[model samples]
Target: MTDSLKKINKQIRFLSVYAMVSSVLLLIALFLILKKDRITGNLTVEELTANRINIVEPNGLPRLVLSNVEKSPANLNHGKPFGIPGGNRGGLIFYDDEATECGGLVFSGRKDSSGKYFASGHFSFDQYNQNQVLYLQYLDDNGDRKTGLYVDDWHNSPPYPEFRRTYKETEKLPNGPERDAKLKQLLEPVNGDPAFAHRVFIGKDANKASLINLSDKKGKPRIQLIVDSTGEAKINFLDSAGKVVYSLPNKANH
Candidate 1:
């Protein structure tokens, strides 16, 4: 070949090499930018849309999750689902240091085919390894609405997951004496401590009564201070049997 032709071929090869090297460098730069965006922050966006988003700890444990109904997660115990899988409503779930579910906020509203409507919102916090100890909830079942804040006691012996497992197993049994007996046994107190008990309720009931109800450890209502819809107010003290043993403004006082 002539010298001029050889020089032309050399120029073409050099251009080809340069283009390939430039493409590789561009890719490396893009990858670094993406990694930095995820790990170190400083990236900004105007908007983002997604079905579910999970924010995790450095070790990959989930710290928080925001999700839609179809992609919602179930109750998590130490990072594993424990209760009815997929039973949890769409909402935000908060995890504790141990990766256990510590609290949550959930809400839902819908109308049935029969034209009945229902809505509910709940915010609750759980005791370590147990169920909710405090909560505020609102429920509307076909327009019968009740909103309340409640405090409760739960057993610490059986971890919540174990208790739920046994309860689910008991529910599988046929409706009979055996099933009833199992339910009673499972629900009864453990070594004199109640398995679960509602200790206080402060809210408006379906009857439109604003009230404060205090219960004993066994969950028996011991006292109630109420103001009915008509604005009539009274205080009632009850016996363990749940019968009101005393009331303010009795016949003698009135």
Candidate 2:
């Protein structure tokens, strides 16, 4: 090849290489800036409401906790990633940890003049039930949202089977010899103890689970299968009148 032609080809090669490098550098810079911006306002109210609470970066990866005081008690999972239960996406679950299950009164949602669903906490307390609700925000096919309770003739959608379950360990305690020992530990009835016994609800779920109903004999149990839990549990198996029917680990009367 002629020297002139060779020189021209080398210059063209340099220019092409320079263009590719420039394009790559520009993309990297863009990504970094977006990353910074993404972190600034990452925690949305939708997350807290749906109980699908989580933190994400621009790329949708989980957020790291700088310290405990800054973290909501709900976010602490003892090393598991923010594994909110709506699968990889997320979900909305309404609940009231302080309410009694007798009549299901506690609710969290925006209540408008017509008592339609808005964005607010309008909890009520029955004689024994407390009006309180927690919001869950999660990303689903419908995207991020805040779910709430259904009040007196209030308009609300049906429950999401995937987001909540109230009953604790629904299947029976497996009466056979295999599970007898462990079942005894979990089902120790509070026959006459002053301390109330309870099966706690702990998870991202919001649906009220099946109650732990005792058999005709006070201490005999009937396990109603339901989803996992969400960390707010009181110790009591309420009667039809919202009083304690059975408690775990029946205490000895002094």
Candidate 3:
């Protein structure tokens, strides 16, 4: 081949190589720009708005929900009904690792048909797949107000699955004796069994008295230390039937 032709071939090969390298570099630059757009380290906004917001784990498990009454999600595992519009309740609800509702803080207040004012704030934590085991509550109905902390017992008979089944069954029944009977039957084991009872109560009662009431597994208030709204203090020891077996200042002054 001619030397001039050979030189021309060499120049062509170099141009082709340069073109491939330039294309690859351009592709890499474009890719980097696109990737940068996707990666956000920070954001600034004047406000954020939503009816319901769920905060989830990396694996898409819901950890928490912030919702208004109309948008509150139902706790199907716990047999909780869905929120109704204009229910006048709203708060943050939390979920367990299994995405089951464990507890939440909720508040509601409104005037009733009798024009009586009512308000309540509740913070509760539930046992696994069960109803609330601990609750702190404030309630104002009409002019009467009470604030208290409660601890409840758990029973094995109406396990979560059974509870859910019974709840669904009851929902299908109308408001009548049949429904009442069914409900009583369902609650009998839990209510009648001494093993499952309200274990502790400490706070102001409906009578406007501050008291710490201690109960046995049988649900009998065995002891009560109370200070009435009038600042009278007393200590009482009670029998299983709750008759004051022994009391300071006796029954008359108490």
All models, RMSD in angstroms: 2.2, 17.4, 5.9
- Give the TM-score of each candidate: 0.89, 0.27, 0.72
The C-alpha stretches of model 1 lying farther than 4 A from their native spots are 4-8, 175-177
lDDT of 3 by residue, 1-254 (tens): 69999999999999999999999999999999878776744557799989988888878878888989987776645333433223345898888887777889999998978888989999999888777879999999886888999998766655555675676779799999999877766665555664257889999988989999998876778989999989999999999888988888776674
Q: lDDT winner among the candidates?
A: 1
lDDT of 2 by residue, 106-172 (tens): 2223445765553322233221222122222221222223233321211121121111121134234
lDDT of 3: 0.80
Rank candidates, TM-score, best first: 1, 3, 2
Question: How many Å off is the CA of 97 in candidate 2?
Answer: 16
- Give the top-scoring candidate (TM-score): 1
Clash list (residue pairs), candidate 3: none
Model 2 lDDT, residue 74, Cα: 28
Q: lDDT value for candidate 2?
A: 0.35
Ten contiguous residues minimizing lDDT sum, candidate 3? 78-87
> What's the alpha carbon RMSD for model 3?
5.9
Report lDDT (CA) for all predictions: 0.90, 0.35, 0.80
Tens-place lDDT per residue, model 1, 1-254, is 69999999999999999999999999999999999987888757799889899989999998888988888888788888885676458899889988999888999999999999999999999999998999999999997989999999998868989988998999999999999888887888465446899999999999999999999999899999999999999899999999989998686676
Q: Model 1, 217: alpha-carbon shift in Å?
A: 1.0
Q: Which is the winner by lDDT between candidate 1 and candidate 2?
A: 1
